[model samples]
Target: MASDRGHGITHCDDPRAAQLSGLLTRRRQTLGLTVEQAARATGLAEHRYTALERGAGHGIDLGGLKRVAGGLGLTGQPRETFLLLAADPDVTPYDLVERRRPSIEELAHIDLMEPNPALITDHAWNVLAANASVARLFGDPGRAADGDRNLVLWLLTDGAGRRFADVDEVRADAVARVRAALAQIPADATLQALAGRIAADPLGAGLWRSRSPRLPAEASARRLRHPLYGEASVLVTTSRLPGGLQLIVHHAAHLIQSPAPR
Candidate 1:
């Protein structure tokens, strides 16, 4: 059973636990405080604080870490690191935190109601959930993957890849972003497989290796075509959620046709 910590936060995945515990212990010692004193200052039970200082903050949430950080006089990036590490450790075990599935369902429902198309990917870039409008316009996510479902894989390998006006540019951008993301989780088997598949493919291997990676744009105007829509201008936006999830939304941008010069 999940403890009353609220987010079903689990224990740190070993290495992260040790690192965090050591940092907290050192910080407390520098401040010259007993565990009980530190716990009281942080608004945590002494045992809970002890568990955290001992590299076992797995069940701890961001707020708890914030309290600890405040008690430790930790500010700036060090404080942020504590919050981030608590929410998502360095190595996720396929599924780390128990996602509030109902909230995701709600998000999908709301997204589907919009005129735009939206899809959600898990940490490994697998297209786990999507809205109805996307399937209606683009090809179905069902036929996208050979076995596992990844949107980037589908885009790189599928015939629909040709639908972009600047297909090569689109492809290069996608490959670069995927490469950069995979760098963060080297031990992830799914990511390794994806990287291997990309590297082996004649189409994307060169692009993956040669292109300079760019940070993924938060939002960008893109052009795509469909037999029915003819061609549409889309504003693509990506938002990040806790637990390494990403929500990608495609909103149709209103393109005002300018008068042709005489």
Candidate 2:
């Protein structure tokens, strides 16, 4: 999916735009390709490609971004990170505050009815609602420190010291997911503020600088040894709800058919 935000020739002061342009230029140069050569390789017009390298590429389609990334031999974290950076800044699906989300009755029904641990998060990874099972596992997200109700922030910082079988691994996944989410709404001030706080945390900062992709969903199985549910193996699955809400469900190992596909 892409936005018709023009050819992205107009000037914009977004730091991410500059970073992407610089990265594209450097990567192309590293591969010993001139602007014309790289442009031709990616099927982009020469001037359009130049404009893209000059910090104005917010309108690039997903296919264009993928083609560009492939032509440049970008892969793994670097490729994933760059494509996210190149995506247009549209907040509709992500602007939780402005959208009319599902009713509380529906959200609470999942919380109250689900037998396993589950919670709902907004586009910014904020904990919109949590179930008793999830609360029992991670403590009340409402009691999170610094009033940071964000799921990633809560898991890495406020929910610190709580034992997850693989705390660092879990934190890394949280960092990557939050970082990717931020790229789609780089201009959101509220998300930016929370991201700033996340960066201040030593663990979060370390992972943020890496700019890695999140764990593959199909391989994401978390085992927690809580006093309430001792030796419980949980597999995380996410489903999209109306207005871009995300439901995160953690099912007991036996009850889960599988982790979500990557």
Candidate 3:
């Protein structure tokens, strides 16, 4: 029995190492290649190839490894594993979001809102992105102040108040809308930045000072001067998007009934 047991049986040392080594062995076995045949094809001796199959060989040439992989019908497997393993083990699926942020920003221009003035706002109601009509109607008026856009401030402050038919009602509703929007935002950095900008406005200051966000049961109507439609009253509706992006869509109200000419 002692004479029959020639050299010691080679076994992989580490469990993870053994698992990966077993995987390689399986790959080689699946290709119907004997150990000697695999070694000869990759220019390695049978003993060295056996050590590799046992997951004990180091200093194996990468090019030769590729050849051995090819001989073992692991051409795609090595490439796929290289790709999968080349990534940092600490790298998580969440890191993919960071890499894909620009794509999401690009998608913001995908024209989600219709032609009637749609804008993409982050939390706190400060417009981060806007469409052409949005830029034309609201943008031309120089809505940005100190790099901040508080819609409530626009309705309550300076010459901007004249833009709305009844600034008081509009300001109150806008403030309420901001509060509603704020409630939906998490403590995200983007949201906090917008909130900080908005809070810099005088009306926002007052709203913050009150520390009370009231939602009136009755929705109010407000009029705005559209670049094309002179004056229009739109019943503003607020909605939350999948990623907490704020979408403001303005629908032209029904034209008031007119008396027939005598």
Write one digit per residue (lDDT tens) for candidate 3, span 50-129.
76666554556545555565566664446345222223344332222211111365336435444555555544555655
Give the local distance difference test score of model 3: 0.52
* Shift of residue 68 alpha carbon in model 2, Å: 37
Instruction: Report clash pairs, candidate 1.
Output: 10-58, 11-58
TM-score of 3: 0.44
Which lDDT values do the candidates have, in the order given? Answer: 0.67, 0.68, 0.52
**lDDT at 97, model 1:** 35
Clash counts per candidate, in order, are: 2, 0, 0
**Best of the candidates, TM-score:** 1
- Winner on TM-score between 2 and 3 is 2
Q: Per-residue CA lDDT of candidate 1, range 30-148, in tens? A: 78887788888898897787767666677776556667788789876576656655555553433333232326564656366455677777665677677766686566776655455
Model 1 / residue 201 / CA error / Å: 1.1
* Winning model by lDDT: 2
Per-residue lDDT for 1-262 in model 2, tens only? 1222222222356678767776887788788887888888888988878778777776778668778888889876677666767766642334322234557786776666466777877666777788777776677877765357777776775444464767777788877877776776677776687789878988788989986754335337775666543555667777766655778877763533333334
How much does each candidate deviate from the true structure in C-alpha RMSD? 10.0, 14.1, 13.2
> Which segments of candidate 2 are over 4 A away from where they belong?
1-98, 144-146, 158-161, 213-219, 253-262
Model 1's alpha-carbon lDDT is: 0.67
State the TM-score for model 2: 0.55
Task: Sort by TM-score, best first.
Answer: 1, 2, 3
